[model samples]
Target: MLVTGVKIQGRADEAQWVTQFKVQYSNDGNSWTFVQHTNNQSDMIFDGNTDRSTISTNIFPAQVTAAYIRLVPTAWHIHISMRFEILGCKECKTPLGMKNRDIPATRIKVSSRGEYYIINSNDNTSTHHKGGSHARLDRFHYWVPDNDDINPWVQVYVGLGKIVSGIIIQGFKQHWTRHDFIKVQVNGSIFESINANLESTWTHDHPASHATLMFEKPVVTSVVRVEPNDCSETTRKLTNGNQIVILDCALRMELLGCGNIPEHGCVKPLGMETGDIQGTQIRVSYNHHQSNESRLNYRGYWGGSSPNINRWIMVYFGYVVNISGIVIQGYEVYWVELFVIEEMNNPTIGTQEYAANFDGYTPVTVLFEKLVHTTYIKVTPTACHNGYCGVRMEILGICDDNSNP
Candidate 1:
C-alpha cells in the first residue's frame, strides 16, 4: 500500500512534550469515529520542527476497507486530524476501532544483573569493535569472550519507578571449573550466591562457560554494579570465545525488540536453522533412494513419512503488531509439520501438531504463533521425493513501531 508520507510539524516532532493523541478515521467522510487514544512513552515532541516518527501501523493487509485517516495532537487541543485514503481501495468494510488489545502495557526491570554485559571504565566509543559484554533491560546481554581477558560485567540502577514490584534475571551457565560461581547482590549488600559445587546445581562441569546471574531484591536506588569475581580460572569456558546471554527484566522496561542486525558493535546470532537444505546446513531430502523410485511417491506420504533429521526450529515473539504473516525458504515440498507444546520444559498428550504451509517454489513463513511463547513449537518437513533443494524465504506484514515481546 502507498501513503502520501505524513509530516508532523511543530511539537509532534518531539514526543517528550506530548502526552496523548486522538486518532480518528472516516470511511466515506460522511461518518467519522474516534479510533485510538495513546499516551506517548516520551513527551519529547517539540515545537517548530517538521519531524514525524512512523508511530504504529495497526491496519494489516492494507486492503481492508477504509476511506480516510487523521490524527489529532493532544498538545494542539485539536480533535480534528488530517485525512488520507486507502490508496486504491474505494469501499468501507468495517467500523472504526482500535485494533490493539486493552491489556496493561508490559514492564520489566532489573538492577545489577551479572550476565551478558561487561561494565568497565574502559568504554571508548572511538574503540569500535572493542569487544565486551553489554547490558539491556537493566541486565547484561552478552558474555562471549570477544576480547582479551574478556569478562561480562554490568552496572545497573532502577530508580524507584512507580508501581514496580520486583525483578527476575535468568540465563544459561556453563561450568568450566568444579567450583564455578554465580552471584547476586542488591543495594550494596550480597543477597544470595550459587556455584557448581552447590548441591542444587542441575548442570555438570563442562569445558563450556555457561552461567546465569540474578540479583534480586534491588534497592530501587540510583546506582548498582555487578561483575565476575574472577573468570580467569574458567579460561577453557570460552565456546569460540563467545557466550550468548539473555535477561528478562520485570520492572522498569518492557522487553524491546533489538532492531535489525546492528551493523556494528557486537555480532548477531544467526538462527539455529536458516540456510540451504544440507549444503552448509541441515539438509532436507528424500530418504527414498530405492531402485523402484515409484515406491517413494510424495503424494502417498502426505499423511506422514520417514522422520528426516533436518529438524525445524523457530523463535516466536508474542505481542508484536504488524507481524501479519511469515514465509519460509526451502524445497517446494508440502511435507511441513508443526508440533505445538504447552511448555518448553514439558509436553503432554494434548500437544497439537499440524502441517506447515509451503509455497509452490519455497516454504512460506509458517503462521506457527499468534505471539511468542515457549509453551510449544516444532517442525518436520515432508518428503522431497527427488533431491536436496536450495531455497530462500521471505515474510511480509504490517510494519509499525509497537514491538511487544
Candidate 2:
C-alpha cells in the first residue's frame, strides 16, 4: 500500500518521522509480510502536513494475503522529535480531521520477536496471537473490523513428513461441516469461493441450518489450502458458506494433519496441575481487560506450546454449589483444554476442548457437564506456544456474588 501525505516541517533532522512508514499482514501467525516506506518506490502523496491539506492513503490488496491486517509504526524514531498523523484510507477509513474514535482505528500495541509495538490501521498486519498458530485445531485466530467488504487470506500447512486420517471442516466451532475441507492444499489453490450450507436429515452438530464439508475415509495430504470465498450458502436461516466474517477456523485431522471433532483423531497424553506448588486445582478463575495487568491482580501471564504432543494442567479445589462454566480472555489463542477434579485429595484429569474456535474481542467462554467443587483450579497451557492467556478466566460459579466455595 502507498502512503498518502506525510511531512515534517520541523526543519533539519527534526523532519525524521516523515522518512518512512510500514504496514504488515499475518495469516497463521508464523510468517508475515511487511510493506513500508523503506521500499524502493516512493509513494508519499503529501510533502508536508498543512492546516487544510487533504490526507489519504492506499491499501494494496496483495499485501494482506492472510486472515487479519493492522497498521504499525515502521520508521524508527531516534529522538522525541518524530510526531505525525496518517490520513485517508480507501480500504480502512476513520474520522477525518481531529479525533478518530472508530474501533478499527484504535491504537493497539503488539509484541514481535521480543519487543513492544504501538500501531494503528495504517499498517497491514496484527500482532494479536492466541499462543502461536500451530498449537491446536480447536483454538481460534480472530480478526474483527467494522467493514466486512475486505477479505483476509489465511494459509494452513501440514509441516513435513506429516500424515493423517479423516478430516472435518467446521464453522463457528459447534457447527460441523459434513466434508473435511483442508485448510491448506498441496498446490496454490486460493480457496473454494462458493460456500455451501449442509442439506437437512444430517447428523447432529449440524446447525438447524449448517455448512459442512466433511472428508470421510480420507487419506493423508501434505499441505491443505483454506481461503475466503466471496459467495455465501444461504439456507435454512443458516449461512455456513465461506462468506462469514470468519472469526476463526477449526481443522480436525489425525496426526500432524487437522482433526475432526467428536471423532477423536489422535489420542495424546495431557498434564495435570499438582496442588504442590499452586495448591490444589479446585477451580481456576481469571478475567480480562484492555489494560488487564493493571486491571486485574495476578502473579503473571503464560501461554501454551505445541499441540497433540502437549499436556494441559488443571487446578482443583472445593467450593459451594459446584461449578457452571469457564471463561478466558485472549488476543490470539489456538485452543485450550479444560479439566476439573472432584476433590483435592483425588487425581484430576484433562478434558478436550469442551470449547473450540474461541476468538473475537469478547472473552472466550465454554460450558461443560462435569461438576466441579474445589478451592483450587489448575490452569495449564496446551496448544500453540507458551505464555500468558488472552483473557484472564473468572471460572464463573452457580452463584455470582459470593466466592463461598
What would the TM-scores of all predictions be?
0.25, 0.26
After TM-score superposition, what is the CA distance of residue 28 in candidate 2 from its true location, in Å?
48
- Residue by residue across 1-405, what tens digits does model 1's lDDT show? 111112232234343322234445567877865542112332222121122433322221111124566555665323323222122222212211111211111111122333343223353222222122222222233222222334343333322111111222223244222223333333212222321122223234332232232222111121232334334422221344433332321111111111121111111112223221122222223433221111111112212243555433323333333332233333345333332323343333244443332222223223222222232222333333233322232223332233333
Alpha-carbon runs more than 4 Å astray in model 1? 1-25, 32-54, 70-311, 315-324, 329-334, 337-355, 358-392, 397-405
Off by over 4 Å in 2: 1-318, 331-346, 356-362, 386-391, 400-405
lDDT of 2 by residue, 1-405 (tens): 112222232224453333234455566666765643322443322222222222222223111223434444434335323343332222211111111111121122111111112243454423433211322233343222112323323333332112222223333344332342323332112122322332224343642232333322122222333433332322122242212222223222112222211111111111111112222232233222222221111333323332334333343433533343444434444233332333343344444433321332223333333224445444454432133343234443332222352
How far is 25's C-alpha from truth in model 1 (Å)? 4.9
- In TM-score terms, candidate 1 sits at 0.25
Give candidate 2's error at residue 97 in angstroms: 29
Tell me the deviation in Å of residue 70 in model 2: 53
| Predicted model with the maximum lDDT | 2
